[model samples]
Target: MAWYGQIEQLQTIFDELERLLPSGAQLTSFIATTVHFMDCLINNQRGNLFTNVYHNSTVRPFLLPYIPSYARLSHRKWFRYAFIHAFHYYCSFEDFEDERIYIEAIFLANGYSLDFVKYHWRQFLKRFNFSLIELTDLN
Candidate 1:
């Protein structure tokens, strides 16, 4: 009964969130979606449930609509430092068996968009068996 109550609460929240911000919405809707995603994160912490909420997402996609037309990404070594910490944090939690994480890390390091990586996910998957040095050699 208690779990069902939590599910109901989440459903209510998502209902209001999606009603206001359907996919490919305007800039304001994009911003609101980001807020909703954050709220979703705050509400979930068990790390074991497959809620299909914001946990299954990356922040860049929501914020991309808000980015200006003149926006550009300049890859720098400093950014790698932060990513190193983030990558290790995820690795520490997982068994380090998922190759997709490493490929995603490389894409992020090179300033690639999530959509780009996802589109080429199959090619990335083929490289899963590559050695550590081989992984680093990817473009």
Candidate 2:
């Protein structure tokens, strides 16, 4: 069938690429409905593509400490950017919620107050003029 031919072609390409790898390096790949790459988990579901943020299991969760005395303008800016990236990267409300909680945990671990994180989270939702429920319904 056409599907079998496509699989053969793909294997050929993978073999060629593997041959080009430098010494002591190995080709790591997955052939499945889902795969993780960088900060995103890519999925192919019934021919539909979806994505969610990926967290590596081997890496420790840590961030630069956010000391009250050392709070800089850049710190606040980075927080905003993190929220924006989560909002844009997650394809579903549930995924976004998970990322939001993970972000809060990282910030809290770094010494940010719960109130501070919640306030900015609310502002982010307000800027988009939508609640989590609305996002779920839309998706």
The per-prediction CA RMSD against the true structure, in angstroms, equals 13.3, 5.3
- Tens-place lDDT per residue, model 2, 26-104, is 8776677888877777888777777777777777885654568864645766677777888778877777878888888
Cα error, residue 56 of model 2, in Å, equals 2.1
Task: Score each candidate by Cα lDDT.
Answer: 0.41, 0.75
Q: Using Cα atoms with residue i matched to residue i, what is each candidate's TM-score against the true structure?
A: 0.23, 0.64
Q: Whose TM-score is greatest here?
A: 2
In candidate 1, position 114 carries an lDDT of 79
**Ten-residue region with minimum lDDT total, candidate 2:** 1-10
Identify the leading candidate in terms of lDDT.
2
Cα misplacement distance, residue 100 of candidate 2 (Å): 1.0
